[model samples]
Target: MMFFCCSFMGAVAQADCLNTENLLKLDAQYETALQVGSVQFLDKLLAPEFYWVHNLASLQETKAQLLMRIKKPEAQAHQRRSHDVSAHRLGNTVVLQGLSSVDKLNPDGKTLRTSRYQFMRTYVEQQGECKLLAVQTMKVWSSEGN
Candidate 1:
C-alpha cells in the first residue's frame, strides 16, 4: 500500500507541469494586435483594472487609457516580440517571466524606437479560475539580446 501511495504521489508531481504554451499563444496574439495597431485582442486579454508601464519610464496606463492610445492614428507599426519565457506555479499562484523587444516605427521607419524589456507577470486562481493579477516591466540595453 505504501508503494502504491508513493507511485501515486510521483505521478501527481509530474502532472503539475504548468502548460505555458497557451500563455505564449496569448502573448503572440497581443503582439500581433499591437503591430496591426488594433486593440481588439488587448481589450479581451486585459482585465478591467489592468495597468501597463512603458519602457520610457512613463506613468502606468489603465486599460481604458491603453485602449485609447492604441486606437489613435499614431499607433501604427508598433511591433513586439517575447522570448525566454519562464513560468512557475506554486499552489494557486503562477508567475511568468520573459524578455521582450519593442519597436515603434516613425514616419520613415528610420527612427524606430527599439528597446529590450523584461517582464514579470503574476496570476492567481480566483474562484477556481486563473486570472492575471499584476505585471511589471523593466527596460535594459543588452549586447547579447534575448
Candidate 2:
C-alpha cells in the first residue's frame, strides 16, 4: 500500500505544472496587480517576511508597506514594464531575474524620466502556496539603454 501511495504521489507530481505554468501565471498576476493597484492580490502574492530594495538605494520595504503603496493614488501614476525575465527553480524556491523599464507619469500617463533597471526576486513556497519573498532592483546606466 505504501509503495502504491508513493507511486501515486509521484504521478501526481509529474502531472502538476505548478513549477512551470503556475509560476508564469503568478508572474503575470503580479504584474497585473501592480498595474491595477490591487492591494489585496498583492498582499496574498507576497510572503509575510518579504522585503524589497529600490533602485535608488532606499531602505527595504515590508509587505504591508508595499501593499499600502499600491493602494495609494500616487502609485497609479507610475508605470513599470519588466522585460527579459528569466526564472530558475531550486526545489520549491524560484528566482526570477529581469530587466525593467519604468515611466513615472505626471498624472496623465505621459512618460517621465524613463529609466532602465535590473531586478532579482526570490519566491518560495509556504503553507502549500508560492509567494514572493525578496526583491532587489538596481538602476541601469544611461549607456545600458532605457
Q: What lDDT would each prediction earn against the true structure?
A: 0.62, 0.69
lDDT of candidate 1 over 12-112, digit per residue (tens): 33443234655555455555665665565556455676777766556677878877887786775456788898888787767788888877665685667
What TM-score fits each model?
A: 0.67, 0.74
Name the lDDT value of residue 108 in candidate 2.
59
Worst 10 residues of 1 by lDDT: 1-10
**TM-score computed on alpha carbons, candidate 2:** 0.74
Please provide, for model 2 over 1-146, each residue's C-alpha lDDT reduced to its tens digit, 9 standing for 90 to 100. 22332233343334432476566656655666676677766666678899999877676788998888878767752556778888898887888888876566544555465667798888887656677899898988533253
Q: Report the CA-based lDDT of candidate 2 relative to the real structure.
A: 0.69
User: In model 1, which residue pairs have backbone atoms overlapping below 3 Å?
Assistant: none
What does candidate 2 score in Cα RMSD to the true structure?
A: 9.0
RMSD of each: 11.0, 9.0
Candidate 2: misplaced stretches above 4 Å?
Answer: 1-18, 107-111, 141-146
